[model samples]
Target: MTRLGNARLVLDNEIRPGGVVFAGGLIGDIGEIGPGGDGLDLEGDYLIPGIIDLHTDNLERQTQPRANARWPSRSALVAHDAQCIAAGITTVFDALCLGDIGFGKARNQTFEDAVIDIAALRRQGALRAEHFLHLRCELPAEEMPEMLARAIEDTHVRLVSLMDHTPGLSGQYGDLVRYREMRRAEGLAPAEVETVIAELQGNHHAFHAANRALVIAAARARFIPLASHDDATETEIARNAAEGIGITEFPVSLQAARAARARGMRSIAGAPNLVRGGSHSGNVAVIDLVRENLLDALASDYVPGAMLEAAFIAAAEGAIALPAAIGLITSGPAAIAGLADRGRIAPGLRADLVQVRLHEGLPVVRAVWRGGVRVG
Candidate 1:
């Protein structure tokens, strides 16, 4: 058995000084608030459940490290897995886009390569963190149905999010001028930018409703949980709730988040948004939602490290207690993803935990153990 003691245990409801013992990949016991452990000594640091990230674009970032610099798929997967482990994440749902919305033609290729790379790495025992696929379906893309058909066949896919990123999508991206500027910054000529925007809008008008129904049907058929992305209004949230979408990912406004809560849906915000104090795109702030009791979970989104940092930041900001803040990245997300076996410090649960020592008010990850095996 592995006995780790002298640490602050972030339990489901509160934080207390305690220890836990584990063996055979399961927590054998949780006791010993005082010192006297036979194995590892935590030495007064905070010990919490390993983070469970349900949506992250870190794989895509790793796959394309720089502009025009696409790395090998398997190599990028390995690198991403290492990053996740170091970030104290035990389970990660890699959010990959299935449909190309003209801005990123490589999304389709990235999705395909990631599926194959994840499987290969798992077979070879090369992954440190548990990896799963979260398919991000762009409803306006014409190829979404065809690509989703191939994607859902893979056993790794566990979640699907419906998105409509048609240029100037009202909620999260209401600034059409900003949209055109961003595309132009990407080296697109002004005329090309306009042309692409027109094409995207046309596709959205033609296929958004039909493709949405198809994606919802496919997800329901497979029993995969559905997330609605960047919802802006109560009506949009109500429509998603009626369609049986159980999670609202990155709600764009307070109205949308309140609607999700009213419908008994989970609301996930980006951890980076909380850590940075506001949304990058000028949407509803995460702290405001926390004060309103509207935010349910926090995902890494693009930066895996933001999960741990955001939890501590939340606690420091006096919005919530440390244990509840930790839940935003751990238990809350795990519950949203329907992962019942991990995400908490308790007897008989998987021993996926993280050790952190706060330095200058910043949580620093010191160690990580997944299923009772030290990985970082």
Candidate 2:
């Protein structure tokens, strides 16, 4: 058994000074500091549940660190897993893109290789965090349907998000001119940006409905949780709800988030949004969602460490209590991802925990343990 004392335990609904005891990879007890325990003293740090990140594209960033450079798939997978573990993420859904709209052909290559790499690492017992797949399907891509068919059967695919990145249609790039500018800033010539935009619009017009149907059918058949990415309106939320999508990722406006909540769908805001104090894309600020009680959870999105920083930021803002704020990265996400074994400091639960030290309003992970064993 392992006992950890002298820490503030962040529970599901409250935070209290206590300790945790675990054995056989499960929590054995949790309460006040008990007598005669063979464990380490945490020295009054904060003990929170190990973070569960539902959607992170950090792996993609690691794989393609530069515009024209690609890292080896297995090496990138290891790097990604290590970064997640160091960030106190015990459970991570490596969000991989399944389709491309005439750009970033390398994303398709990384997608194909990541599945094999993750499977091999798992079989070899080389992974630190428990990794799962979150397939981000591009609804307007011609190959999306076929690509998804190849991965939906994989055991690691726990979450599937329907992503439509077609400019001026839906999602982050709702304004065509803004999308064009963004592309141009990425070094695409003005003509190329306009051409790419037109091509994407054409793809959306030709393939969006059929691809969305295929994705929905596959997700429903497997009973995996479905998420709608970048929902921008009440009508979009209603359509997703009618299609049985229970989560709305990064809704672009307060109305859409509120509508999602009204429909019993959880609204996920990017952790970076909270850390940066606003959305980079000029979308709805997460603090506004927090104030309105429209936010259910916070996803890392593209940065693993942003999850921890955002949780502390939310608490510091007084928008929510410390425990509830922490929940945005812990139990809230675990529940959303259908993981019931961890995410709380309670007996009989999986002992996935992290020790955090607060320094000048910033929270830093000091140590981490997964299933009663120290992993970081």
- Model 2, stretches more than 4 Å misplaced? 34-37
Per-candidate TM equals: 0.98, 0.98
Displacement of the residue 299 alpha carbon in candidate 2, Å:
0.7
Give each model's whole-structure lDDT.
0.89, 0.91
lDDT of 2 by residue, 222-288 (tens): 9999999999999999999998999999999999999998989998889999999999998999988
* Candidate 1 Cα outliers beyond 4 Å, as residue runs: none
Candidate 1 lDDT by residue in tens digits, 321-368: 888999888889888888999999999999999999999988889999
Candidate 1: residue pairs that collide: none
